[model samples]
Target: MVSAENSSLEYLRSLVNYDINSILYDDTLICSLTNNTDVGSFEVKVTKTNYGNLHDCIQVIANSQATIDGVACGTTVRAVVTRELVTVQQEHTEYVKLPNPITRIVDFISESTDYVITITNEEGKKKTTETKRIPKNEAQGLILEGANLILQRLMIQRNMPDKVTMLSLDSSSELSRNVYTSLGPQQVNINGKDIEAWGIQRQIFETKPNALPIAWQSFFSIDGHLISRYQVGSPIKMKTRNIPEAEQFDEYLPKPEIPKRELEWENDLELRSRFIDRRDELIDDYKSYIYQHPDINALLSDFLQSVLITKPENIIDYATEFFAPFNNQTADRSLFRFADEKIPVPKPNISLK
Candidate 1:
């Protein structure tokens, strides 16, 4: 029961069948088990309430067994999605004790800052945590497979979307495809107790970019609990089930293997519609450089302000006097002091004609 005086979130509040505000505090821990996939069985523990410093954001932690180049490997993924107007950001990460093959990271470009935390234990061992200040545009169409609840609002409203592209992180690589959605009646039975649910079917298109889509269905209880998931004719079933000791390795799984310097896109569009191949180091350098100087940022900001405010024709000459008195000097520190000091605008030389 949350109301917004600003009405910014009132619309979102109305759209969701369940309480958005209360969902963040629900103590229920939902777990899903996926078995018999090409790789192996995996368990995912979903925390709807709290997972990180960003209170009330969505978090998904998955533990699984995978094979890379035919060798068995254990994998873990902790994906954090900070709430936005529509989509969310996955730019925040903390320390992990175990090793993994890959971890997908996405960023929205902007001025940035990084804060690193290190803790030393009595045994002289240290654990490090990392955080950053990031805010940017909400990615409109991209979706996460593990946190499909992001679509709960639309699902409850019975307004399923179609022809949208979908993206997900697998144990070792990324999986993506075009998709379409449809709604239907569903009756789920757990040990013979039938529970009414909403059946949302999705057709995933990897071949021909959707000429033929593989049928996938997700069933949710009326109150929006993901009760079960099934691919049309596949034996792999993912539903709310307990897999003991799975959540224990959430933080201690092996560190992710650094992706190759070059990226291998699943399709051509994915390859062309990207910026850098892999430049985390360069991005860190950029944030570090910008964080070092707040004064310079202000100085340039004022210069640009004066440029627009004055609208001087000879911009180079105007900038020269924007902070009037070239040398370190008198009290005329005013930006566009020429205007503030009542300096006259340039008068054009016109001979009497």
Candidate 2:
């Protein structure tokens, strides 16, 4: 009797008989980069083709536009992996940076040497390094490694490579060596279903001598689909919250302090003009209050945070209880105290009275 494991292995081995293995890589996939929070997300189509710009190369292209910050932001990524005779060359990538009203393209090619150039921007007029490219050695490029990972997964149980060295292109001065080791096949949970996946452990080694390597684990399906990736020590966190119902607490909000005019005794025209013109003194006074007592801003921030977390029936009452602790001070004293908040006013001598 053939067990499920043996059955899967047998099925994978059978794919090598003909050219039917193209289903795994040569196709289009609609993928989303999102988390449990649903806070920020973008979807794109990833397509893999046998024929690319360069000769004897396979290409993966992802291009799409999504609304970000209420503006349309477009993203385009093209990765090419070339085969030079017997050996596969490193991958070349051209990708757009996610941005606001404008976006720019940046690419990394293995053949080019690394350097930094400085220039000044027209707006800031600050001289900055115009561009930077990471130094590369014999390490494999990420795009090529991803393609290799997908292709090699077909022969996981038979001819999978023991380990491979990859190049790290993070925003750091020194490029680290990422060595990935195959940990054989294992069962992984994806979308609440247990699916078979090939486990891989990556050790990121710094350029320094005798430095320890940081470890990361990843799981991928036999078809080269990435299931999950996580660091060894850190635990992944996923949180969800329900949408809050409507609540009215406008009365509890801060009101601008109406400045008492000393010129009222002299019957000045300022207060008369204030009432007749109605020149939005509340707005001006509110701005002045915000400038003077910045603590009010922190106070309101804390109240809003508590309201968001608790989501009580009466947000006004919740705010009262939240600020109740600091309300016991005298009228003359500071209304609230923050850790770094201080006022350096010399005390008046009691004998002056």
Candidate 3:
């Protein structure tokens, strides 16, 4: 009779032979198959973490066969596997909002200086610095002042140049050489009213004569074509009085007789005489006006307001009320008094007057 262990081994071997897919193995067979002595069958199932609700699964099976007394046997195995779920948190990126363009333009105009720009990230966590040279003021102070005046005039109607391009100022004259392009007519509503205003195009060029700088101004139509050119300065030579020959001789007796020298002497003498005569006449007129009229301060104030006030129309009512009683006579009287205080009475002129 067979022992229980032997019967069990015989039963396992019989099972291996009964199954067509299972191969039989013995001590010798296992040694011949591979170096490892232990052999077994296994089943594995793999699962991976899914980003969303859906998850994926994989299945694998491994097996080894053994035989005893010409009998084959195999053991079945199984496993269920799942991957560790990993969670990732996304990072948020911050953005920055720039300053208001209108406020920048207004500040540039009022200060009449270059602007320093500062950028701040959202939540005020960090800041960056930037520098920009405002074209309006990059030129010398005089040109900047003039440009401010022009911009102010346009600002009243809520209009500005599309782009401002600054060129080198004339080295000889220190005048701005800039070009302004008009983008086009922009419709703006103010106080519940619609108004149409002309868009202007401007270009600056520095030209000759250090004493007189040229301003080449241009205007643009709504379509952006150059419509007009305004040439400023190019000061016309005013006819001055010619010096008498005797006066020239008396003035230039000590100077050399070269043609250029003679001409220069005559010109210098003529200019000097003209300047002296003008100064004397101004003084006489000022004194006479002051002596004839005592209240001149008020007239000066009025003249200043007329020339300097930007919104004359808006202040006209107030000005009329202020000057209601003061006619031209009062104005003249006041002007005369100012002149008298400013001008000194000459000895010869005092006796004649």
TM-scores, all models, native as reference = 0.37, 0.38, 0.15
Backbone clash numbers for all candidates listed? 9, 0, 10
Q: Which pairs of residues collide in model 3? A: 13-71, 13-72, 16-72, 25-66, 25-67, 289-336, 290-336, 290-337, 295-334, 296-334
Q: After superposition, how far is residue 10 of candidate 3 from its true place, in Å?
A: 99
TM-score for model 3?
0.15
Residues 248-344, model 3: lDDT tens digits: 1123235776665344533688877988899999999999998788677667677668657655655667676557656774554654466546667
Provide the overall lDDT of each model, using Cα atoms, as 2-decimal numbers. 0.46, 0.46, 0.33
Q: Which whole-number lDDT from 0 to 100 does residue 18 have in model 2?
A: 27
Candidate closer to the true structure by TM-score (higher is better), 1 or 3: 1
Clashes of 3: 10
Instruction: Supply candidate 2's per-residue lDDT for 105.
Output: 37
Candidate 2 C-alpha error for residue 325, in Å:
99
* Candidate 2: worst-modelled 10 consecutive residues by lDDT: 237-246
| Ranking according to TM-score, highest score first | 2, 1, 3
